[model samples]
Target: MRWFMWAAVAGAVAAVVLAAVALMFAGGDPEPAGAGSAPAIPAATDAAVSEAAESQVTDAPSASPSSSPSVKPSPRPTLRPMDVIAGLHTTVRELVQDGQLKPDAGEDLTKRLKDAAEKLADGEVDKARDKLEEFGKKVAKLREENKLSSAGYQTLAAGLAQLAALLPSR
Candidate 1:
């Protein structure tokens, strides 16, 4: 009947409208359900009706830019020599607590870090640099003796290197 064809067309139009609205809310382009292919309309439907439905779906407005929030990266904080020494101290203490480093070794390393910090605070750049070099040597020896894990050795060595770079050249 003529009424049945009109109803089918109306239903298809409503479905395309709903899909477009859903895509807008999802923050994406309102592409048709099956791009480059005929829509799933009844075989009795006319080509004109299919073409109209496809145009309605494709011509729908795209998602708004304001739908998604923009993000900006925060600036990285600069680390001072004393800060590196403090981090090294914490790393050494953790290693000792985890049984990765013997208490004696940890205590010695911690003392060296403390001394380096104090020397740095007193404007004794050379002395602080010497302490950092000593720490690096001790770390290497421990690694060679199998007393320090490779991870532990790497952590301490990197911290020492960073601290040395922060200090003034001899």
Candidate 2:
């Protein structure tokens, strides 16, 4: 009878220890918002993204005829400086034609864009990028002075951002 009582106590202690161990292995609650950190991604969403990426990897055709298939990296085409400058000019022209920007501002921006393109042609890439950044600032000031609509500002900003992406980072 005494041994039976001891066995019962040991079983209860073991159960409590197991429960504590499980809690320790489980992660704590997620951090609250406004904690000055990135928002936490849900576990399910992360798993889905991982699965999608893995499927893409498996779908790619094998490159070589080895015992195990190897992933081949596809080559991405490089953008030339002039090509990017031209794209900016095209976007600006559309904005002018749409009457979303003042004629004077458009003309001034056009001239500055042409100068930047010329700099790129001359192989002065850094100078060209500097000119582009300067032009972006000018456009922002003009948007404020003209009281451009939100749509107009977004259009101009998008063009500037696209051009900026093509330039090499300082």
Best by lDDT: 1
* Per-residue error (Å), model 2, residue 75: 2.4
Candidate 1: regions farther than 4 A off? 1-75
Instruction: Write the residue-wise lDDT of candidate 2 on 71-159 in tens digits.
Output: 56554355565775676677567556666667777788889899898888888889988888888888888878873434556555655
Superposition TM-score, candidate 2 onto the true structure: 0.52
Clashes of 2: 0
Q: lDDT scores for all predictions?
A: 0.71, 0.66
Please give, for residues 7-125, the per-residue lDDT of candidate 1 as tens digits. Answer: 35434544553454354447654444587688786655578788887787866589776756765545445557787788788878877766667788898888888888888899988
lDDT of 1: 0.71
For candidate 2, the per-residue lDDT at 59 reads 64
Lowest summed-lDDT stretch of 10 residues in model 1? 2-11
